[model samples]
Structure formats: structure tokens, C-alpha cells
Target: MSTATLNVRTGPGLSYPVLTQVHRNQTFSIVESKKDWYRISTDKGEGWVADWLVTRESTGSLNETGQQGTVSTNGLRLRKGPGTSEPVVTILNKGDIVSISETSGSWLSVQSGNAGGWVHKDYIDLGAHSSASASPSKNKEAKQGVITAGTLNVRKSPSLNSPVAGAVHRGNPVSITGSVTGWYEIQFGKSKAWISDNYVELSSTPVEVPATSSEFTGKITVNSLNVRSEPSLNGNIAGKVSKGEKYPILSERNNWFEIKLKSGKSGWIAGWFVQKTVAGEQKKSTSSTQPAGEKVTILHNGTNIRSSADVQSNVVKRADSGETFSVTGKQGNWYEIKLKDGSTAYVAGWIVSIRTGSGSESSPSRNTSGGIRNKVITIDPGHGGRDSGTIGTRGTLEKLLTMKTAQLLADKLKSAGAEVIITRKNDEYVSLPSRVSLSHYYDSDAFISIHFDSIYDSSVAGHTTYYYRNYQKDLAYDVHESLADRLPSRDRGVRTGDYHVIRENKQAAILLELGFLSNPAEEANVTSHHYQDLAATAIYHGLNDYFSN
Candidate 1:
């Protein structure tokens, strides 16, 4: 038989029914042949398939078709009809060969002897000598756009401030057009976004709002709140304000404020620290007042801690002589002490006798700062919950892999004398921005994100590291170099990336693509425990280098 390649045709026109996709190979049985059509016997029943898609044998047994090997991998669901949203009839498992009865718009109408429905040809491999090549058609390049606001962010996804892919300063234009969830879609303007929808914006030409200096009215809430020159905590403190005083909000910077106090002292306060009143004055919330609890006088000069635990780890700050506090509860040798400034601290139980009500039940040490241990190192295993990051071959989920590697890395870091803090301990998804926010919440010394890589071409494979901006390049290099040396796979070489989570982070950050999951060999290696340990070790060493330097 002169073997020929099969052409999975979609109707007469390629427009309405697009050639959805092609399988590597599949089988077929021809019952009747026409000029350009063949009525084939499928498991479902009789159906007409395009004759152009079949190659025949010289013996003429199946001059246009051949039977492919049968084995069960996944079941195929029967569709009500052809097209994208067709309803499923039922799922068919392997070992069952259905007859191909007809073809229309990329769908092959089939029958399993008695049962029948249409199946998208691409999903099932039909054994036929096909001359066609399986490759992705070139997609039109999407144009990027500019950031029209004072500052606009490119995210890991289309949502607000998703882990920042990169940032566009005021007036800088970007090439963005695609959109998802009310946000413009951008993939780092190229393949760099390996993750889709990594950049977003409202529209290409956003309505410009003039940057006019505006004043807001509100009351000061804290007794002695430090007013800063900028919104960030690191911003210079312009002055201090007394509680219950009124101020005019001069301008806004995210959650920070530019304000003028009633006493004519001008400065900025964290927006979260004050609430705007109806009269335009800012009012302090309950931040300045202490929570309800029985006051206590320490008997042994109570030492203030972060939680009600005496473990060397429990102490974040120490209470000095004459420090008064309200005893909220108690646990082994520790009391939950509330400071006069409304902040809660844990005090040593041996130094303070409960002067009032008993303390609350002692919770797990891990529940609150791990019950005062040594030092806590926060670890983020990146990507969870609805985000299906760069999918790899054979269904290796990045989220699962990252979590596993993170856990391993945490253990290694802990063994080296540091308490580990894991932002997420499960498979639940978390946004990139949230991951960064959580890192700040824990004040982690370093943050690492683990992930796998996927490429359109299966041949491209290796590992790489990414860092946002210049400050984190050293961290990226350390992790990348360590991974290259420790991992058992091929190194793609460490390169700089504008990943949002790493770039926007104020703390040291590094993201590692351990290996390309799309690459069969690399994918298998990444799934192995041995490789995971190597990855963990590399990351640990990288952190050590970063901190040591």
C-alpha cells in the first residue's frame, strides 16, 4: 500500500469549521468510497468521512484507510453535535474502536455499533498514514500598549496588581490589546510572560485624569502617629500628630496620604491608619485604643514577647521596667499581653502573674508565630487556587510541584538553623500580588518562588531563574547558579526576568523554573524526589549566599 498522510478536513470551507487540531496518528475503516467522500464503519454506526483524509493499501483491503493500535488511556466524551460548545453524550474508554461515519467542520460523526455521536477529530488519534505535519499555525502578533496613568502595573494575570510582571512609568506606552476580566492582557509583550495574561490594563487609551493636588478632610486617630513624606513606611517622617485632631487630606498615594493638620503641620499618614469622616476630616479608628482585657502588674519584670510562649523564639520585642499591660490570656509560662498602644504582645508567665481573668487556651505554636521559637523564615511556594500555571507534559501541575519543592526547601532552611514560614501549606491558589503582600506581612528575609517551564516547541528545554529589577539580580544569580550546579538536568543558564512578584518585592526575591515540564525527560526529572532535594539545596545555598553577603 502506498502510505499517505491523512487530512482531517472540516466541511468544504476551512472558515466555519476550522481544523480544530490534529492528533499524532489514528486508525480508520472505510465501508464505501465516493469521489471525495467515504462512508466509514465506526463503533457508533455508519457515517460519512472525507476521503481525502484516508490513505489506501495496494491490496485494496483499505486502499484509503488503516487500523491503528488500540489501547486505553483516557475516555472520549461523545458530543451532541460538532462545534465548540457541543453537549457531551457519554465518555468512551480505550479498547473500544468506534466507526467513523461522517465528517463536518472538524468533527467525525461516529457510531459504536449501536451508540453514536460526533467527536472532535483532534481528541482521538485515528490510525491513518498521514502526510500532514502537526504544528501550531503562526498567530498574528498582538500590539502592546502604554500605561496612561501616573503608574500602571503589568500583572501575572489580568486582575488588579497580580504579581507584577513589570511596571510602566507614567506616560510610557506598552503594546497591549488583548483583555481578560476587565484588564488588558499582556504577556510581557513577548514570550517572556511564559504565563499568559501576565499584563493587564483597562484599555489602550485610558481616560486621563489630570494629576491635580486635592485635599481630603479627616481626623487624626493615633495619639502620636508619624506622618511621612511618602506613602511607604520607609518614607521620611514629616512630623507627628496627636489623637482626635482634624486634618485636611492634601493628596493620595495608594494607601498613603499627604495631609495638613489643624495645627498647620503638614505630613503624610498611612491611609489605612485613618478613616475619612463625612465632614471631610480624617478620624482615627480604634487603632489608638487598647482592646478590652484585665490590666496586670508584672511580679518578675515581665518580658514582652510576640506570643504567649516562653520559647526563645517567642520574643520579638522586650518589655522594659514599669511596662504595664492587660493580660488577655495565658499558656505555658506565657501570657497574652496587650500593650497600651493597642498592640498585643506575649509576656513571660514566670515574670507576670495574671492580675485579672485567666488567659485564653494555648493554641498550637505554629498557629501564632510557631509559639515563640528561634527565628521564622517565610517561604512562598507560588501559584495556587484557580491559577493553572505553565502546564507540563503528562499533567505535572506547577502548583503541586512548587508546594512540594517549597516544603522541601523549608525543611532544608530550618535544618540550617531558621524557623520557616510557609505562606501556603496547601493546593489552594493565591494571586502573585497576594504572595508578595504575604511576604511583607511575615517580614521574611527572603522569598523564593518555584515553578516549571512550558514551551510551544517540545524540543526547547532547560532550567532558568528570574529576578525583577536590579536589586534582586544578585539573589537570582545565586539561586540560578546553585540550581545549575545542584540540579541533575540541563541548565538553560540564569537570565533576568521582569516577574511581578519578584520585581515589586521590597525584600530579596528569586523565582526558579526548575526545568521544562514540556520536555519529557526534564518533566520526569522534576517529578522525582531526588531532583526536588537538589532544587531545595540549591535554593537554600542561594539564600545563604544572599544573607551571608
Candidate 2:
């Protein structure tokens, strides 16, 4: 089977009782095939599994050592130990090739570059030793290409619906094997993986660098940024630098800033975390003074006003479109605004337009007929295909639950007069970037990603809502509070999270952790139609409440 553990059921559908779980790479004899389920003969007994959960591989066997496995799931965690309780050492992207050394139950001991750790065996595709190896001639003939996207996703297959295998940052060199419809099959490590052709550029020559002066200075903008031996995130960590630390800029690449270390050696830091400075200028303050009492209009609806200028700072209030605020001060990229209560707060400067005339125009009024009338909402069902997400004690799949909940939520939103767009309607894989792209593509007013949580300690169960940007905090809290009030579970409270989809989305985005599937009671409750309907209704009301305010 392709999954870490495939549930063995008594019948061919979800209605059947689960018998046991079969581990990944396990061989089985097919007895029969139903619509979307398969009846197979295992060593224990005859059991049924979902057809989409496993890949049909030719009859073969592999040796324990020296076997090669390709990562088939996006952002799969590599743990220090073999279980979920263990701390995550790093993340393996889809399309990453790993050398399999040993197998422990449903986990594999794999070596990807200099790191070695245990990953769920189900997310890996094991190949025979012969096919896994490449000849010297083939290696020499492989064409090279440079990644163009800030962070390009490597998939297990060519389709956008395929499971993510790994990721490559901009300027990273990759060996291209061939091309499909709109994707490039690349040779990553010892195995083959695919990436969208739109993000890769064919190159016969090396990356060109601009000539730079002898001395340039840079300052760290973020706290505790890691310095690496190479530009890539997978590179070895050389050291760390705290915020406000200044260093001599030695060179620059796509997203990496190479700086001269105190030891006279060179180290690379993420370009996003470093602010370049002039040869002799001092570090600039994050805040500045603006004309007092100058009014500005909020261009976007639901703009957040935080206690400070930083995105990680606490959000104090939300300003709606066309709402006017008095400018009190200014931060690096934020405008300190005076609220109606005479309190000062900061908003991102990019989302507001300064008003030169009298601030007499009132904010836009909401439709009383429906909470989200004419508003576009994008609903994202979390993992799918090969990414089963967290499996429950009773064999309930988080992916299946998320899809069901997303569909229910879409129906509720549509009934409330909102235009709903689902990232995926069925059991298919969609990358985090693709989901964010869909929100922007549809010009959605709000984006909500549906997911379930899992933990080693099953007793720790709750419902949570997460937002990345400060502007999304209200949406997160509104929906979270509504859902928490309706559900018979512990409230985990709203918090800031750094998820790729929410962090990169152009529109307001939030991720809802419905409940913990690891907990027996919560899993049963969350998977029921009654609970799903309650959640859908709560979200609908929350959207209405947020838009009304």
C-alpha cells in the first residue's frame, strides 16, 4: 500500500468496521475491486481498503539496505525518533529522494543528504535497486535548469493534483530528465521527481552574477536568523545571528545574502531576513514621526490595527474599507493611526490611502439580507491523495473529514448568498502555493483552509483557529469563537501561525483546526454529520458577523 498505514475494513466502504491497519510497502493479493475500495488478502485475513490509498505496483521485492525511496508527500516531517511524539528534525519536500537504511514498523530510517531521520513510510515510493540507479551516460546527458519561483514545489507526479514530493528555492540548480504537458521531470538525488515547467528555466550556462563593490553592509531584521554554509534551507547550519546584528555583505544570490563572518569566513542568510545598508549609513529606526492628526482612508476591507508595526505584534482592532483614521506616527512599513477611541495603533502602510481632504466619507455599508452577499470565499480541504494526514485510532482519515467538512461549509456559504470556491472538491492533492493562487485567482474576499489536528497524547483535544498576517486575526477569531461555542470540545483560542497558504495569500486567510482526530471522542464527534452541520452553520454566522462589523 502507498500510505503509512491503510485501514483494513470488513467491507469495501467507510461504513464497514475497521479490522486492522496494514503498513506501507506491504504486499497483498487482490481478491476483488469495488467502486472505490479494494478487497485484498493479507497475512492476517481478507480486508478492504480505499482504492485511491494505494498505488498498483508490479510484483517485486526490495532489500532492506541500499533501497531507494522517493518522498511522495509535501512537507513531510522527518522526526528524531520513529513516532509522532518525537521532535521534528526537518521537513522533506515532495520529490526528495532518500536512501532507505532500515524500516521500523510504519516508519523508515532514511538519509537525505547529510541528514538522516525517520519518516512515515507511506509517503515514500520504494523502487528496486536496479531502476533506482542511474548510468554515468544518463547523468552526463541530463539537462540542467534553474528554479525561478521563490519556492517551487516538487511533486510526485506531473499533475497539479499530485502529491508534493519536495521543494526547491529560486536559483537552485536541478537536473531535468524530460517534460510532460506543463511539468518537468527532474532527477532529484537518486530518483526522479516532477516540478511545474512554469517555475523552471532551461539553462546551459551558469547563473550570472552582477559585479559588486568591495564593501557593503547588511543588518538582520528578524530575531535569531540562522546562517548556513550554503544558500539552500537544506544546507548545514553554520551559526545564528540576532536582530540588529550588522555584517559585511560579501555576495548575494536569489534569496540568500552571503555575509562575512567575524571569523573571516563566509556564511549565507536568508535575504528576506536581512536589510541591506549603504557603505557608511547607520541602521534606520523601525518607526518614524508623521504629521499629527493627518487622516488616511483604509483601502481594503478588514485591515488590522496592531499594537506595534511588526506583523507578529498583537492586533488591537480592525478597520473597514473607506474608514478614516488619524495618522499619529509611522513605522518602517506601517502607519500609526489614531482610532475613534483616541487610542493609537499601527496598520500596514500598503493597505491604506492617505486622505488629503476632509475625512467625511463613511465606510461601506453591508447587505442586511445576507452576511456575505456577493463576497467570494475560497474553501481549502487540507490533505488528499497520498497525503492522508493524521489517522485516528479508529481508522478515520483526516483528509476525508476535511473534504466532507469543506463541502458542507461551501453549501452553507452559498446558501448565505456568498460565492464559494473550493480548492479541491474530491480526493485530490493541491499544493499550498496552488491553494493560495486559487484564492488570488478567484479574487476571494476570504480564504479558509479546513484541517484536523493530531497529537501523540490523545487526551489533548481542542478546536483552534490560526491566522498569519495581522489583518486576518479578526476573521480567525470570529470563526473560531463561533465554532468553539457550537462544538462540544475544548477551545484552543485563536493564535498566529506561519502556514504557507495563509502567510502568502494576497487576501485575508485563516486556517481552522476543527478538532483533534487523535482523541477518540473528538474523532467520533467531528466525523458525524450533526457536528459537521453545526460547524458549517457556525462558520456561516461568523462570516456574517465579521462582514457586518
Candidate 3:
């Protein structure tokens, strides 16, 4: 199949019901063709699939010495050698034909038009003219294993001294043909390759279990708990939850609890740090309504109290860390509280841990001195190394400007008692995914990506803050307002952008475009040390405002 998993329908049309799903690298026999769909014979039964979703194998005969094959996957890399470690020569799109010159374990040396390179055999379909029969091989009776490592290296030989031929990511299914010492021989592509046994889990059969709702209610007990993408610790960090945050348990695997996110996605958290609340206890806690005007302490710093119970309502003020307030009432996921001036407000219940108390003191003043203490923030300096980003008329590089600004901002955040992480400390190229991954891995409270804009029109010299999701919109506006007020440029205002780093980031992320590089005056101002300091100070204050309110 062309896709990772495609739904097989009972009929070729869109109105048909789905019979089953087929995974990538799986093969099926085509029995009939419709206007834009194909009826295939699968192990389950006959099913119809959209023609665009599958790559039909060619029935043309192949020569004994040199066979013809077609690329079966989109963006298939053709490398200089028969291994993933080799440099990529070109990329072949699906349906592109090539001449197979030779084959090495799981990899095929092929010439596509004038370009020749090695491609993984799994992404190619040899024509029927090949001498090899369509029937299963005698060695098909083998064990199955799933790669558990983030990236397991495949070596040319079983020894560690051998060159790395390829790599497989976590959750990849591999057929284990043989075992040698601490290595497992697997059918990688067109040939067999050896992978370290330590990273592969041998299984009798593949298992696909859907996440289901459970009766468990999980509460985080630690100061902060890391949520991951998979059940294993080696899995990438996805997000984090504070000590008092609660989530509904969706499933459990080993020592991890699969929990549902506010976005409706699933994430895994360490089970050891999560305490299961008994159903009876939960019921008892919510059974009796508390008296109006009861007091509750806000455990977290910078908790925003809105005019209404909804998050989108106007923010009345922010409660400082350890501040106390009177609970007027309760709304869905919100606590209605009485402000210092006897005004009513609402704060998110999840962000603040509440404890029963008597109304004694007025709301404390916002802690401006060190509200960010112990908070984690990630800074990403855009475009480095060979990527110079935008160049100004005076030859000022965007990469250098971003780095200088980011370093200054990091210093300011650190001085404010916040823990700061710079995605790139030097002039090294950091991929967008890596930048986002670093933020998640650190469980940062906020992520900022710095960059300078360049356009054909030099007149567009201003600062703009971009955010992707609704949760990040407040942060974007907070930071942008500070910069707009302090900077010596026009305000481009806050906007929704589709930038990769911010779009894919799990934390509150915002991308700041300081100024336009194409404008000489703006470039000169942004490239100066004084302006960099001002920018950094503005961002520092912006973070304070963000957290405080």
C-alpha cells in the first residue's frame, strides 16, 4: 500500500463500508479495476481500495540478468551505496521505473534514467519477468521481531566493526531469519542484514491493540511528570504535567499509563509517579457542595483569573504563586474565585492545586520580582551553519542576528531565575524537528523561536509574532505586545502561522520575527548590540507578563 495504513472497503466507491485496513509493505493480488479504484484479493477476503492509495505491481516480464522495477513509495531515497549511512544521490517518486543492476541484502543497485544509486528493495516492485516465483520461500518460516530502539543501526556484517548499512526506527516489524551471537539476521530489503539483538523484541505474532477507556483516574504526584510518545523510556518526550494535574487513564503498558491529552491525543506517562484515585473517593469529594465564599490556595504561580469561567474570557488578573483566594463557586474545569477588590473571577482548576481553607487574607500582589524562578524555557535560534537565512543589503546575516538575540534572551531569562535551554549554542545546523524535540524533552513551560524576516519589499520592516494553536495565542500576543512597545520598529502584530517548529511543538510556542533584513535601516538597528539587549529585555518582561497573568 502507498499509505502507512489504508482502509479496505466493501465496494470501490466512497459510500462503501470499510472491511479492513492494510499496512505498508504488504502485498495483495489485484483482481479487478474500476474507474478510480481497484478490487484486491487480501488474506481476509476480496476488498476494494482507491486506486490512488495503492501501487499495483507491474505484470511485465523481467530479464534473468537485469530486472526492471518500479518505485512503490513516494520520496524514496536513492543513496550512493547500499546502506542508509550512504549519501543520498537522488529521490525517486512512486511509479518511477528503474533498471536493477544488482542486489545486496535488502538493497538494490538501480539506474533510474541517468542517475544510478542504491535503494531499499522494500520500496520497489520487480516485474513478473523475474525468475523468482511469486510463491513463498522455504526460509519463510522465521521468527518476528519488533524494533524497540529509537533508531537501530543495521551493519554490513554481524560485528560492530562493520560499516552501518542502514537503520530502522522504533515500532518497525522485521522478519528474523537467523541469530549470530548477539545479532539478529533480518530481511531488510532485497537481502538480509544484521541488527543488534538487544534492540529487537522477538514476538510470535504482531499485535495491534486500540486504546480503550478505563475506570482509572490518574493524578500526578511528582513536581512534574514527563509524558512520552511511546510506552518505553527511549520514546521521545511529548509533554509534561504538574503535580496536581489529573488525567483519565486510556490504557496501560508495562510501567507506563496511556493518558488522554486535552487535544484528545494519547500520551504515555510513567505509571510509578501517577496515583490512581479510587472511584468512591472521587465521588465522595464531589458529592457535597461546598459553602459559597470558601477559601482555596493557588499552588502554582502566575495563575490567570478570567472574567468568566471560560479560558477565552477576559483575564481579570493573575494570582501569584502560593496566593490565596475565596472560592465563590465552581464551573466546568474552573474555580470561581473572589478577587482582592471583592470582584468575581475564574481560574483554571487544573493549573492550580486547591486546598480547603478559611477566607483570611486578600489576594497577594503579582510577584514581579522572580515569578519565573524554577520555570523552564526553550530558545531556538533559527537558520545556522550553511543556511545563512536572509541577508541584508549591508551583508547582515539573519542567522547571526538570531543567534545573538537568542543568547541575550537566554541570559536574561537565566538572570530572572528561570532555567533556559538554547536549541543551538553555536553556529550549527539544528533541524526544525530537533528544535521542537529539545523543548519537549526538557518539558519547557514555553518555547520561543527567533528569526528575522526578509521580503522583496524592504518597506515591510516590523516585528511579528506567530502562533499555530489556540493555547499558544496568548503567549504570542503577550510577547508581541512587549516587543511592539519597546522595539524601534512598526508592529506587524500577532498572527497565526504555519511554521513547522511552532506547529509541531507540544508546548506553548511562538515564533518572533524581529525585523525585516531587506530594510537597511531595520537591519542596521537589529544587528547592533544595544538593540539586541533591548529586544532581550523586552522578551524577558514579556515572559514575566505571560506567567504573572
Per-residue accuracy of model 2 over 273-392 as CA lDDT, tens digit each:
665533332322111123334577765456667897544468798777779777765433356777888888887654556653354433222232145767899999999988898998
How should the candidates be ordered by TM-score, best one leading?
Answer: 2, 3, 1
- Which runs in model 3 stand beyond 4 Å of their true positions? 1-366
- Give the lowest summed-lDDT range of ten residues in model 1: 280-289
TM-score per prediction, in order, is 0.34, 0.35, 0.35
Query: What's the true lDDT of residue 198 in model 1?
Result: 18
- Model 3: C-alpha RMSD to truth? 21.0
Q: After superposition, how far is residue 422 of candidate 2 from its true place, in Å?
A: 0.2
Q: What local lDDT does model 1 show for residue 521?
A: 43
Better lDDT candidate (2, 3) = 3
The sequence of per-residue lDDT tens digits that candidate 1 reaches over residues 1-549 is 112433333343222243333332445565554434555554445555454344433333212222222223455666767765875544455544554545666766654422356676776566541222221112333554433233344444432212334344332334443532224444342323211221222232322222223433455656678888677767797788777676666666655667876667677886544644223111211111222455544432234456434232455666554455766543322456667677776664423333333444332222322222244466777677787677776688888888888987775454344667787889897777888897788777767777888886554567888877677778788768767765546788767777887877887777778888776545766787656765776676666656555
**lDDT (C-alpha, whole model) for all candidates:** 0.55, 0.70, 0.71
